[model samples]
Target: MDLIRQARARLAARLVVVTGASSGIGRAFVEAMAPSGARFVLVARRRELLEQLADHVRDSGSHAMVQALDLRDVEAGRAAAEEVLAHHGIPEVLFSNAGHSIARGLRGLVARPDSVTRSVAANFTGPVCHALPLLGAMCTRGGGHFIATTTVDARTSVPGWSPNVASKAGWDAWARSVAPELRSDGVATSLLAFPLVATPMLPPARRARARCAMSPEAAAEWVARAVVTRQARVAPWWLRPHELLHAAAPVLTARVTAPFSMRLVDRG
Candidate 1:
């Protein structure tokens, strides 16, 4: 057990790129892996927070490279990927965890096309924009690990989360379809179906329902464990039952979840 633990830590402590590194799960992942002496490329829009995390990573005796940019911009995401490749070389791991959510009903989302656009760009287009170049480089090198943070909403398509659900569903589908193809190129892909984690992304009411939600730190540790164990899917054990239920009866599952998800709607 100790050997396995040590090995996991060592494996996690390698050159890696993590998007959305400023806070929540991204920050926790950095903190959790720092002790293993992991070198990190922290990508996020917040310069100050990225610097703070870089300092924290450096303090832990690891190298930290900061790329402060919004992943929603395809040009910028590509530039950041290029810069990282130029300086740090291709990372052994790419954690495409950056995302955005809209707690608005479909009517509300339709009322403001701009919000829907941004949400889609952030949750779906952004990761792919940043990842394609990086993944190509990894394939050239003969191996790499790609971890994408997804959600149960993708499967259930809960109300008041149209943008979030659709965007993640697209991302999730892309990862699943490509995982097998990527494997032939020696690249491994993981689509992590996260049940609500207590992160800044969630509204106050949602965060209060703590039974099903994992702490960001716990989620981060789980991600690291997946990387170490080479697991293609990283999710809480409790989520399995929910997944099975959805698989067996998606419409019924959606009906059951609708009322609770409606609470997330921005009625105003």
Candidate 2:
């Protein structure tokens, strides 16, 4: 049972929207959240996969609507959210969990600007597209939860993959800015950042990064609890102090971690 289920009747009272619902963390999210007994809007690019996840969630006796769309397009966010509203009303929790990582850096992909741009839009701008309307609605409604699954890259900039770091950093800054505002209205806002996860988003050559990676199911369940319970922020508890230090002296940690990360990434 979910820790958020303590007030089952109250919590089950509204829909929840989770982006990146096709595979990895997204699919795991559908599975993790199914038992919460809330109507769900699952959005992703894989139509069949989303439908399959929907069937599985419904088998658990929960309601779900699967919409296949590309968040990179951004307009798709509005269309998908609008559909959810038309059928299920506003959601209680909005989860932005879709993202991918590339091990190679900009210098490595000099010829593929389009590819780099897509990654940036998907990892960063997608959250803004999905959340702006939801934020407005949730604020007006007086209570709701919003979660953005950022990357540890949001903190440490990678030389090779400037797009990923830059984009996710934008996401982190936006989330931080919005958190205080949302709290004033009783809406919980949180940003969950992960190191390399063992989810399918893990690139093969960089498999070493998932050495101590979190499982998709675990990430999903953890994030589900985060948005639902209104936990202010979450990361590995031990990292809290490090995060504080990172805030106080990002360049120091960046200089320290970069060489180590570079060597590891270079090895693969």
**Candidate number of the best lDDT:** 1
Quote model 1's TM-score: 0.92
**Per-prediction TM-score:** 0.92, 0.87
Best by TM-score: 1
Model 1 is weakest, by summed lDDT over 10 consecutive residues, at: 1-10
Residue 175 in candidate 2, Cα distance off native in Å: 1.2
TM-score of 2: 0.87
- Score each candidate by Cα lDDT: 0.82, 0.73
